[model samples]
Target: MKMFMLKSLCLAAIMLIAVLTGMQLASSGIQKMKGYEDPNLETAVSFHEKDNNVKASILGNDISSHNIAAKKKKLEEISAFNFFSSMGKKLSNGITSASEKLIQFIAD
Candidate 1:
């Protein structure tokens, strides 16, 4: 059924997002900030700015789970966030696909 396929896709998207977020957080040596600094992070469909906590809507369409990282990345190809890549600097963890693009974009 079409509904089943939609549900499966939705679940897959959610899992993918979770895995990405988890990996980003689970890396060693790179102290993870609670959140990255981005003044351009737009108002979220469900956001509140209080007590230094920002809850906002980010990337992804309504049909699927929203990917905040992807949302933060929209039009961010020219940003300064990419220069300080800690990826591959350590022997254990390697670079991520996103970090590669960030490096390339920064180099360009």
Candidate 2:
């Protein structure tokens, strides 16, 4: 019994150490990437801005106004989507909790 207890404690300690080490490694990797910027994204945005400028100049329109309107529309769509998604999640959680309670009550 003593040997079994010792082995179990050793195993638990080893597992704890392994988990902590893995977490530290993962956090450090994430920290290193925090300041990393995607070259592709930067290039794409640059190209888009240049294209908008050319188009606006050709058509004699203000590019800033068009960009602002586009950005506003995009933000509104994102906000609406997030609101509906969060509501759906809450509804699902409520149904799950209710069902669990009902099951427990019936079991009792």
What does the lDDT read for residue 87 in candidate 1? 42
Per-residue error (Å), model 1, residue 62: 26
Model 2, range 1-108, lDDT digits (tens) per residue? Answer: 999999999999999868756765665576567777444321111113564454332123345667889999999888755788899999999999999999999999
Which residue pairs in candidate 1 have backbone atoms (N, alpha carbon, C) closer than 3 angstroms, thus clashing? 44-56, 44-57, 47-55
lDDT values of the candidates?
0.56, 0.66
Candidate 2 ranges with C-alpha deviation above 4 Å: 36-108
- TM-score for each predicted model, relative to the true structure: 0.28, 0.32
Report the alpha-carbon TM-score of model 1 versus the true structure: 0.28
Error (Å) of candidate 2 at residue 43 is 33
Name the best candidate (by lDDT). Answer: 2
lDDT of 1 at 83: 38
